[model samples]
Target chain A: MLEQGKIDSRQAILLIISLVLPTAILTVPAITVKHAAQDAWISIIVATMAGLLIARLVTDLSLRFPGKTLFEYAEEILGRVPGKVVGFLYIWWFLHANALIMDEYASFLCSAHMPDTPVIVFFILGIAVAACAVRNGLEVLSRFNQLFLPLFLGLLLVVFILATKDMKVTRLLPVFDKGAIAILKGAATPASWLGEIVIFTMIIPFLNKPKEAYRVAALATLFTSFYLLVSILVAIMIFGPNVTGHWIFPTYNAVRVVSIANFLERMESIAVAVWMFGGFAKVGVFYYAAVLGSAQWLGLKDYRPLVAPVGVILVALAALCENIVELLDFLATAWPPYALSVFEVGMPLVLLIVALARGKGGEGT
Target chain B: MKKIAVLLLILLLTGLTGGCWSRRELTEVAIVLGTGVDWMEDGRIRLTVQIARPGAFTAGSEAGARGREPASWVVSAEGRTIQEAERYLAMKVPREIYWGHCIILVLGEEMARKGTGMITNFFQRDRQPRENIWVMVTRGEAKDFLETYSSLEKTSAQAAGFLERMKTGYSVQLWKLAEMLASKGIQPAVTAVEVKEAGITPEPDREKKSPPQKQVGLAGVAVFKEDKLIGWLDPYETRGLLWLKGEAMKGVIIVPSPGEPDKAVSIRIRRGSTKILPEYDGEYLRFMVRIRVEGDMVEQQSREDLAKPEKIKTLESEMADELKKRATAALEKAQNEYGVDIFGFGDAFHRKYKKEWRDLKDRWDEEFSRAEVNIAVEAQIREIGLLTKRAGVPEE
Candidate 1:
């Protein structure tokens, strides 16, 4: 194998955070409000705990087989054919996830601002940007996110301040009104979204400090969950639980209600611009993972050449999603447990069990 | 050489495609000032749009050149569906009607009584119409309501704009409509626009031909269950609903003191909040809504000695009772006659007692009507208007 460059533990953590957190910020709050009501924020906390437990299991498995990617280790532990089958399944998951992310960006833009603009335009633009980022390799992508993440965080804080005048604490009254079942059901979608952090297992062999990768992942999970919690709380406070549940984009609606004065009105356009950056970061990371995984599965020397073609496929698939309602239905109903089984509970558990049974125990590196 | 040529071609293609995708300029489109929906005599929905004549409004000279009325040009069309109506209207208008800037959507009382869902379908489906655009039901024909210009404001649009900004009176927006539609428990309520004869003053000569009459003022609120308008609330009741929803921004309240014919006090609401607590007792679900208000006295009608803490406390208790009376009256009317829970009591109960709400979901209307409700108000008199005592009266 050609010499593979390594990423620092911080870069790995940043990659995971940048990829998993933005989608949660945009979509999770609305979805949680639908089932959990005011306890939507608590649902996010539950999802985060589930995510951290999965991350720990994946990290433990990766540590036992240091310097080797999950794909390579699966072959040694479960034999070549079954491992290859698993690898193929993982690639399908990554590609489908990429399509879904692209769909989210297109739907949000179409609904929020550019009504006349064709959805295909967003698809093409997203794919073009994502393809370029993927072609530059993971290190370049990580560096770009590291530079933009602080701005993203600062923009969120600024929104919180602007919206303080309208925040109603009574909106959060009578917590857990719907019983525990509502919150548990609501946690399903966010937990599956958080499971996307498992992509770190595929990238962990390329980390400079593999020993610290678990801690980094855990920290990233906590930070992303906290950001999601704050977002859910703010959205509920601004729109009230009932209103928050009805709107397609609760955060965008919350920002729309932000009016400091006559001149400060229509501030939601600024949020749309900021969220576009988050969308780009999310798409770039997912596209990069898909490209790398495909190249590895096909035994290619480099992933750069595959980026454009796969990007085209993803853009096409995203546009082909029937409409906004269909897209939402797919994400809410079809995605949760399917994604949870594969990304969270299924693959990580299998790898950990295999590693323990082999008794090689932290010697693969 | 190939790379250079390909790059140039790609750049040219991008510019061409990008230009076509985003060709809408703000100036080229006629911003819809307001929208009115009415049920015609023929039973079809009549949709009217007040399109701002940008050329005429922006340049005062154009208004003179066209010999047209001031403010805006109105376009009317009729169809079974709002989308079809919009398309018909589009054919008659010179420029495309853009709803992005539309601030007010009005429904005639007839149409509101028939159902507002058909008229509101377009606003909900179309992405351009903002979720916060004010929705109102007019007592008269919606077109007439839109056409009535106010003398105090620049135009009827400006008058409607002022009402939206007031935020203290009756107001409901598109997103609130959606929330009401989605909530299993609560019914929707929106502001009502009524046309009052614009204080016609008889000419002194009495022989001159009478000029065209004008109408103005939009007060009261239309309450709806599902999509049908069921009842109406006067201005005071609307203010009561605002308090219940915790949406009261700034409004003056007048309370008459007992045994003093001229001792009515005017209070300016400064801050207020409401909390709904849901508790279940066996088969009965009881709701306790506690309202806390802080206000400063804006006017004192009597010569009662001012600067006394005990007197202020008396005023506070009276104001609190007034608030309770108004809130209870509003709730009773909404629940008993209208059979609508516009105060979001159902949503509150759902959040507070989820499992019990689930059991009571099917019979929420019955439960809502029979459910016990307690209203508690706490009003603090912070300051005594500008003057501590009534003007023109000497201090005791």
Candidate 2:
């Protein structure tokens, strides 16, 4: 197996945020608006709380086994065969997740700009760039995220300021118009996205200051939730609940209405560029995790050789995802419970039982 | 080292190509300034495009003529679809047709009456057209409508731009159309333009009489129900509709006394808002509409005393009653005759009572017709005009 490179707590936190937050902000608002109406933002808040609890559990698992990855610890805790099975399943999840992210990025680009260009070209180019980054190891990815994070946050703030002229705060009135159950349903999909932090249990061994891992993860989770909440609120204010639900990308459409004195009109092109940047970062992180997980599972000497082949497989799976409707349906109904079982329920319970039985429980380092 | 050099060469070549996928130079493309859509007798679509003459625009001044038609060109084509018509027009021209700069979309009365769904799909689906472009329906053939040049503006395209800037008139943009289409309980309304032949006095010296002069004016509004144009509202009714919809911008309202000739007051609108409250009274559903307006007095008649509070109160009451009367008449015509709920009553009900709407979703139109509406107008004359009294006021 490839020797793991050490990542500091700060780099790990940035990696998690760069991975999970981008797609969460871009995709959650439109999906939540359809089911939850004006209370969609509330659903995001609830989902964030659930995400925090899952983060705590995953971090606790990491503290139980210091310097050993989840793939290695599972065999020591459970029998070797079952641990291997779980390891293989996690690899499959990462591969599928990366493919879905790639599809989302390519499809969004196709709809917003360059409609005539084949989406496959974007998929191939995006995966190729991501493969190069993954080959450089986690340190390079983390550094790239650190460099671009400020730019991403600045663009978001600019979008908020420019859209203030059209924002109607009254549109958010009559809160909980649908009921509590709708909000709960809306929270389910985003909670799954947030729960992907379980991957941190595997990566925590790489952190230089393993003790500070929980604090960094919590901070990253908090920032991501706040960003997602702002995105939902902006979408609801620009387009009323009825119209927001109908749009595929309500935030993009909301930015399309940003006309500052007529000369600054059609700045949606800039929005498209920013969107692609964030999407690429997200896909890069996920693709790296998938390739690394595959190499670790296969017991290969190096993950570098596996990166290109896995990247091709991920792109093909993304192209096979039928259409937008099927992708959405899969995210809403099937993915959430599957993700909860692996990330939230299964991993945490396994670590808890193993830690109690071993009786060497004061947070291994 | 050899591999690195090969990669560097490939990168340099890629950069040298400039990597512009869909860029067309300004000179190589016919920048569509405006587009007009009309319906033909054989059920085909006729599209007229106003393309700017790039060379003439650069030359600045024509050598031979005084006006010279602003040095622009117009082309018309007919086909089964808007895209097909565009393709046909492209065949007659040497340059690529670009619509990124197109500012206006005009629909003729016949085409609008038949339906605007098909006409709007082209703009919605096309990547070149921006969603902020203004949409209008004309009262006559759209081709003839675009042919009319204005004396004040450089081209008919400039005239169309002026009309779009007149926010006081009934105006709708593409985003608003999309909202109306997506909304469950609302219909779309667009400004209407009409071409009327201007009477021209023959110049004895000129051999070529100016081809029958035409002028464009804002005429009524085209109201659509489920993408089909149901009916229209006259200019006065449109003003009233705008007031009720809280979209009125600086239009003047003239309130004339019943039996007194030349006895009228002109009020200029400053700000306005309309609130629709839906109430269920066990038997009949009723809507309570409250309109609040603030305006300045621009004209006065009958030598009414202005300094007294009671006199101001009387004037305010009279103005409010006049506004209510006009607004009620507009509502009555839309409700009783046309039976189209253009005022977004369904949206109000849906927002206020979501549970009830879920049950009454299918029969919304029926429920809207049966519902009773009460209108109340509150007008405040904040200030008198610069000339408080009429120009020919009697010397008290």
Report residue A302 deviation for candidate 1 (angstroms): 3.2
lDDT of 1 by residue, A91-121 (tens): 7788788788878878888877777788888
Q: How big an interface RMSD has model 1?
A: 2.8
- Cα lDDT of model 2 by residue, A9-115, tens digit: 77787788877877777677888888898888899999999889888888887688787667767766766887788777777888788788877777677776767
lDDT of 2 at A142: 75
| Cα deviation of A36, candidate 2, in Å | 3.1
Q: What is candidate 2's lDDT per residue for B209-270, written digit by digit as tens?
A: 76767866678788877777777888888887887676755677777633353688778888
- Candidate 1 backbone collisions, by pair: A177-B351, B297-B385
Report the error of model 2 at residue A290, Å: 2.1
Q: Write the per-residue lDDT of candidate 1 for residues B213-271, one digit (tens) a residue.
A: 57546577789888899889888788788778767646877887433646787888899
The TM-score of predicted model 2 comes to: 0.89
Off by over 4 Å in 2: A1-13, A170-181, A300-302, A319-329, A332-334, A337-365, B1-11, B40-43, B56-80, B154-158, B197-212, B256-261, B300-310, B388-394
